[model samples]
Target: VQILDETGKILVDSGVQKQYVDVTNTQGSWVVTTPLVANQKVQVRVKVSDGSLWSEWSEPGWMKYELPEKRASLVVGEKNSTYVKADGTLWMWGDNEFGQAGLGTTGGKSSMAMKIANLENVIGVAVGSNHTLALTQDGRVWSWGYGYYGQLGDKNRTYSTYPTPEKVPNLDSVVAVTAVGDYSMALKKDGTVWRWGGSSSGVEPQKLNFTGISAMAQGNPRNAGIVLKSDGIVLDFQGKQVPGLDGVVAISQGDGFSVALRKDGTVWTWGGNSYGQLGDGTTTNREKPGMVKGLDEVEAISVGEYHVIAMKKDGSVWVWGNNRDGQLGDGTKTNKLSPVQLAGIDAARIATGKSHSMVLKKDGTAWSWGKNESAQLGNGTTVNQLNPMEVQFSSK
Candidate 1:
């Protein structure tokens, strides 16, 4: 394998470099070191041989380099994973049984990362229980996979799954999208909220007349979607406002509860507590938002099926709720009713699945633990891990 510049000048040759192979076969990655110049156009070609047979050099795969920066993001679903690169290309992996990976096929599953074909200029992405949505730089929205509840926003509530990304009809100039638990929600650039799929009101996106809305959190099945107005007031999907909360900056809705982060560095939660997801030191469900004990200066929050994780401003991570699958990452399977700090690491962002937890470290590396039933851990195996493990991708 060799990397060549636009003039066909070989810059890095791998033929004489140290090669790495997996003896366990479960490992599926190789490390290739090369120095890349900004705004450089490069291509790579590879050939193979096996004692008795030799293969010709493969066609060159071209790529353009951008200024190196850690601006990428990741989202983990119930059985799939989506990653958006700094260059605006989206990539997916994990279970594709329902075509949720958006790889243009509902064919079984793939442990290898597959770039979502034809998806470009993607500025943001969100994944639902079995569907996916992407927001482009031009404000166009695209959707695919399980549309049983009309979450695709195509105006039809048919029980179908799209293998490829299809533009959501009747929506444009959208700034954000949220796909979760059979339902979908979008916020237009006009400060208006639009909803579709699985909401009690039915399938088509109905415009909520409330302006000054800035952020939203979609409930995960049977829970009400909540949004934050510019004044920091919280309102439910039915347009009814929830009192006792103000100055909210961000929000997250879980399986049966909703969480709000305030400007004062406090975390508040409401709704079902069957799994102690509220993290208030009890199993009592609160109809109104209540402060989560022992957490402050929270920078971001991520919620899974019945668990929640908070990243503090100091770069520490804290978790609570369901630990049946070790999603809590406390090195124990015991569920906690109050938040517990996950020691020994600092993170820039956090993403959660139904039963797994992942964090992108400040150093640009990804780590995950818990449910690996569908290889969601991205560690090239189908084994559940109770501790954080680095995810390695195969090199071409």
Candidate 2:
């Protein structure tokens, strides 16, 4: 067997190894010790032993990783942070507290470049505030990390000490899942949903069945995604009724009020209305969903602990509600009652952590702005970011 670089340079030639003297009857590998640059060039040839004659070299197989590229799908947890490239292998880096890094017991947070322990064939990822969830090709869910809130669904409260992938019970046919703050909600292929985690309301609603859920929105750990029902209202995953208005395509809830986007592109807000967080064209609060009269055509929205960011179909960004600590990303500490566009850059995708907001551009690069105290902005330092800044992903 032999390994070659893309330029036809031989990297490994097992045919010449002295240890392979009787290799004519067994499968063997030639390890190249040289430092090879990423995407440098590579192919492998396998020789099978057949009696006195050697088999022909096998077809060339290129060596390339599968994560963090143009369509980079990522799995970010407290530790063992990972992302998948277009080809599909996963790469991760971060604090490995509690064996979430999945490299093994030895694969603690400080470990380097090791493949995630015993994990592969992953296609989707969801991260809670402390744990992580991975969805596989078979529609099964795998979880690792802290399970204090029964987030890992072990049915017992024990911190997972290593990167052990466990199938989530009662979720064999899930189609989509979201894990934020602490709890998790997964939508099934049949449009029904299931949830687990102590964060939910002490009492859950019953009979939550629907034909299809077009969009879902999640709140903090205790609050869950208000699944938009076919009857034009929102319900908890369990079919119990929940608070909020109709025709909501997206909902972003913060500490004070919850914001919802309707099918007509208008915004509706309810819940905590203190500090004018509802943005209903007035400072008064409403227990039921009410339209934000002047603003319309919102495509997507994200809620921070106290603020909100919305995206229009034309690649424009809007911010309003809470601005203390500058979570609004509008370059000011002033609370806004109407949508305000972020200057300088165009946004295509919107994602928000506790207080920070991240946007993915159409060109494949990612930029994050807003509160950066915890280095959530990924710009190298812990300083706050009031505007968008590019993230320098490791080349590996």
Candidate 3:
């Protein structure tokens, strides 16, 4: 591999450079070095042996010389990054290749934090492929990520470089909000649910006309959901009761399915089951919620892109579904048709990134596993894994 200047000039030549591989196989450094020899303008070019002849020098990684500048927030496209500090301050990193970081136009990945101004009461933060959402205790939602799909919900197509709260014509009454990947969902005080986004999210779940709705799980496009009433009844958007289940206390988003945890500790699931992600011990797809059969005492649950996880009241973690990307944390790449106990993880809180999961312990510690292609695992670099590892949070 050789680092070259824009005019095809050599910057750094790894003499012979014959031992290198392509970008996909490289977890991180094989293409460009970190600290990047400081303030240098260069990109990556490679040569490889592919079964026969050495492949021609491949196209460059296209990276260029960039001077370091600080920012408060940034948003590019699919790649988004943000963080909440110990002092309640906010920071961002990633593709901001488009200024979606909310820190003005300082796009591109930043190793430092960009301060989102004038915003207070920061409680939680979420990112989409190119947009950002910040949650405040006052029940207000701020967005600055992608706006191209009307996803910003600000009803404007112009991109923003700072956190701005948008009121969905009828959503000023929203009580809580959630954004997954590039879609958004809101829960209302009237036991209703609301949402907006791309077709990928499917058709939006209808607005319910109920009084006791207590919880909601992701729904079709924009934001739809399976509403769990206070009386242990599940209903669709028009107030019609959903058949075949009850006792749901929590609901989570999964690849092509939804997992609901009943108050009694038993688990129920429905929707796309191509990978048997529902944990019913079979690969059959069920349009309505079905019981998980034997999982009891489940205290918490989370859904990965193609996998599901549950935490038992006894500190045990259960994993299921697509294991090809190791999102199951099952110590192997083989997918599971039903829930399997994830050995050795003593956890309290659980969170699922697109293809990875994080386990937060009672000791202020965290463990990560699955895809690390973007360093979402926080193990210090981009490397996918089949098992969990301690995440060293960078405070610097």
Candidate 4:
């Protein structure tokens, strides 16, 4: 057996062995030890020998060597944290009073991150106040946790809580899922949005009339929904376009405000500014989107209950708004009316709970801070961290 490059250059050669096979031995496999570049095109050729004479080499079989996706993702809820490792395995920790941990038990809390035993191939996850939703690679959505408000979207509203994963029926081709408060939203591959739970939508998933949505964001305390259309326009759930907000590449909603990241790397925010979560250097809320003060070259942004986190193109993280619980990760509990750089850390992705913050570094390590009374930080303690602390995960 030989593995060759596109140009027929041998990359791996498995020498002939003395092993013999009978007619019944139809199933066979080989473990190739050669290290190939990711996404590199290659070919394979195999031949059989009968101890004396060798058969002709078989026709080349074309293949591509793609390394497993190694990007880690983090999502934080009101008092729980969900993590998806590079291997597509899901983990949960912290508050479980309403069974948000999805460990098949309620009224219990886990200080250390535990791997979800029955869920796998999870590409994305979203959490509400007490419920959780997971999106698999095959476009299926699985949910658990509080269902009294129909947040589970399983069409069974009689059950108040689900401690384990249950399929959200009639939901397929879902490319993304997000939940906040008691409502959930899903973005389909066809650019349509489906919502369930909350006061407006009931237990069953209801397809919104709008289409061409590329991404979405939902607020925690306000129950507001914002969507980013493929044409770069940002619109509210009521089909109203946000004034002066266009060319948006991403959008996020917090307690009572919403944020948009433009293609020029500038951030615009509006809505509740009680804690200056809008980052406009003023406590007054605006009816129209305004440019966040002193934020530029921003690559990504996330919103918490009353705080905002923005990662710049240089890998630096900045925070502002409600810091009463030190959710800003600035080593202080003072709220900043303007964006302040979070020192000593480079972030690859960021997420925020109601009163806590999380960062996933490029090196695959995760850190958390702020409110930890429910052990949401996953640092083996329930004490709030004014500074970032490394999260502890179980080996098993």
Candidate 3 achieves a global lDDT of: 0.63
Model 1 TM-score, 2 decimals: 0.78
| Distance from true location, Cα of 283 in model 4, Å | 0.9
Least well predicted 10-residue stretch by lDDT in candidate 3: 69-78
Instruction: Report the lDDT tens digits of candidate 3 across residue range 1-396.
Output: 788877888877765543446634643334332334446667788776543667788888977566434212211112444445444465554445545566566444442335566655455565666667666544566677556555566554433333343434434445556666556666666666666655433323335455666766553333345667888887765557777777678877655677888888988888888887888878888888788876889998877666788899988988888787787777798888888898877876676656677676656566777876555565665667788876654454
Candidates in order: C-alpha RMSD to true structure? 15.3, 11.3, 22.7, 9.2
Report, for every candidate in turn, its global Cα lDDT versus the true structure: 0.81, 0.61, 0.63, 0.88
Off by over 4 Å in 4: 1-70, 199-201
What does candidate 1 score in Cα RMSD to the true structure? 15.3
> Which ranking of candidates, highest lDDT first?
4, 1, 3, 2
**TM-score attained by model 3:** 0.67
lDDT of 2 by residue, 1-75 (tens): 666878878866655544456643454545443434455557866756544676677888887522233355543
Candidate 2 Cα lDDT to native:
0.61
- Candidate ranking under TM-score, highest first, comes to 4, 1, 3, 2
Q: Tell me the spans in candidate 1 whose CA falls farther than 4 Å from its real position.
A: 1-70, 155-159, 199-204, 394-396
- Measured with C-alpha atoms, the lDDT of residue 256 in candidate 1 is 76
TM for candidate 4 is 0.82
